[model samples]
Target: MSKANTAQFFESVKAHGFVRRSAVYRWMWTNYDDLSELLKEARPSWIVIARELNGIGLRDARGRDLASDNIRRVWLRVSRDLEKERQAARAQQRPAEPATSAREEPKRFNPSRLPANYRPDVEIKPQPSVPATSGPYQVPASIDVSEVPEFYTRKDGTVVHRTQEQRERIAQQRAGFEKETRHIDRYILTQKAK
Candidate 1:
């Protein structure tokens, strides 16, 4: 509690590499009763071991053990005070009032802000098909190539006889088809905008 003892305690904290100042409060709680003047003069050694090194546990940080105890004490004190106030208020009671103001009218929504073209009736286009090559069946015009069946494989286990160069050419064609469709989609969007 004295200045010299406080300084000595701080020195001990420093020696222990407890650089954080708030941890000194924890140190005080642990060493609650060793109020010796002799502890002041020594260049007090660092805390070698602590039950907690530093950092609040789930149980007791923020002086919560102390704070919770204080809170309970204050809460009891407040409840007692409130009970006294309530009794006093009851003793000095006045009569209740009758209803005074007129009731509020129900609100109506503004109609003009709603869209005139809002329609529950909607047209849904059919989803496009996936392009399949190397099949006897003709591929549909709207087929999505990414979902296309592998061109090299058939149900029969016979691999298609396209060369590596031909395979690369087909891949390039597929890529070009996808690229052209993206441009076509943009054109469709621009026409729709107009």
Candidate 2:
């Protein structure tokens, strides 16, 4: 074909599309933060994260949508990157591991570094039970009376004062609404600390 004809043909091909590996990687890096958040759930199935990545305009150079499989590969790479970063952070915070020795000597542990609720394996001595006061309000003996607030807002849009009836009602409400949790207690304590 003539040079002009060849040029015309190449132009049309360029206009149509040109998918490439470099382009996909470029797009992934451009949208790294968003992809990390979407994939942070760590769920085994990455179909959802891949779909979200595709939806956010990460595509082939030809402007075609990214495949779930392709996005999954990128997701795995990004997950590895995150893990590496996490490991690096932990390494910075912690002392380097000592070389293994023949002896099984105990390592020193800092009490300040322990988690807020972490308890050492030890027998807890039971306290002598205090006799319950003859009244409607039965606050836990563990809670100091001085720390109890005189007034607080309730979820039902009512403000309660430290009256005998209100105290009893508050105790009952607390018993009913306060559910025990495994992980959230630390978060709650953090919020209170702030």
Candidate 3:
């Protein structure tokens, strides 16, 4: 059925309650006059006028009941587009056969028909290496003496010594020593001088 007639559309939906067919008819007629006037000054499209009325209804203090009306138009547009796409897909699927000979050709591969030593001629370039941003991996470079110990012990009574974190430990101990010395100096200076 053609939904182009707003009056008939409203009449068909008015029986759902909250809105009467007479009220819908009155609204359409009132908006029609406004739409005509709008078409003159700014030459606005009918769609624009209709959308404006919907926006006003949604924003007006006494128009809370019309909130769903704005959504109706948006939903209608979406549903119509979706329906068209679905119908097109269904129509395409209903076709039983292609109209061209290329659609009937079958691809076949016989691996045994080729020579036993047949090899495709291809120039293979080495893949470029990308440096990893994050992951567990080992570098091929020699380990620095400062990073690893010079020796390590194995379970077979093998003793190995490796580079130690002695510098870090020494620096930490020195900082603590300085802090304690400062506190002692402060206590001594703060005592009453006889």
TM-score, candidate number 3: 0.20
In the range 1-194, model 3's lDDT, one tens digit per residue, is 67679878887777454343333333544355553465567875545645665665533234443434553454445446556968999988896556766767686767888899988789889997755523233222343324555544447743334333355578899999999999998888889553
The candidate that wins on TM-score is 2
Estimate the Cα RMSD of every predicted model relative to the unseen true structure.
Answer: 27.9, 27.6, 19.0
Candidate 2 — what's its lDDT?
A: 0.67
Each prediction's Cα lDDT score?
A: 0.53, 0.67, 0.55
How close is every model to the real structure, measured as TM-score?
A: 0.17, 0.29, 0.20
lDDT for 85 (candidate 2): 77
RMSD of 1: 27.9
Q: Which ranges in model 1 have alpha carbons more than 4 Å from their true place?
A: 1-162
Between 2 and 3, whose TM-score is larger? 2
What C-alpha lDDT, on a 0 to 100 scale, does residue 90 get in candidate 3? 94
TM-score of predicted model 1? 0.17
Colliding residue pairs in candidate 3: 149-162, 149-163, 150-162, 150-163, 151-160, 151-161, 152-160
lDDT of 2 at 94: 100
Task: Report the candidate with higher lDDT, 2 versus 3.
Answer: 2
**lDDT, model 2, position 20:** 35
Compare the candidates by lDDT and give the number of the best one.
2
Clashes of each: 1, 0, 7
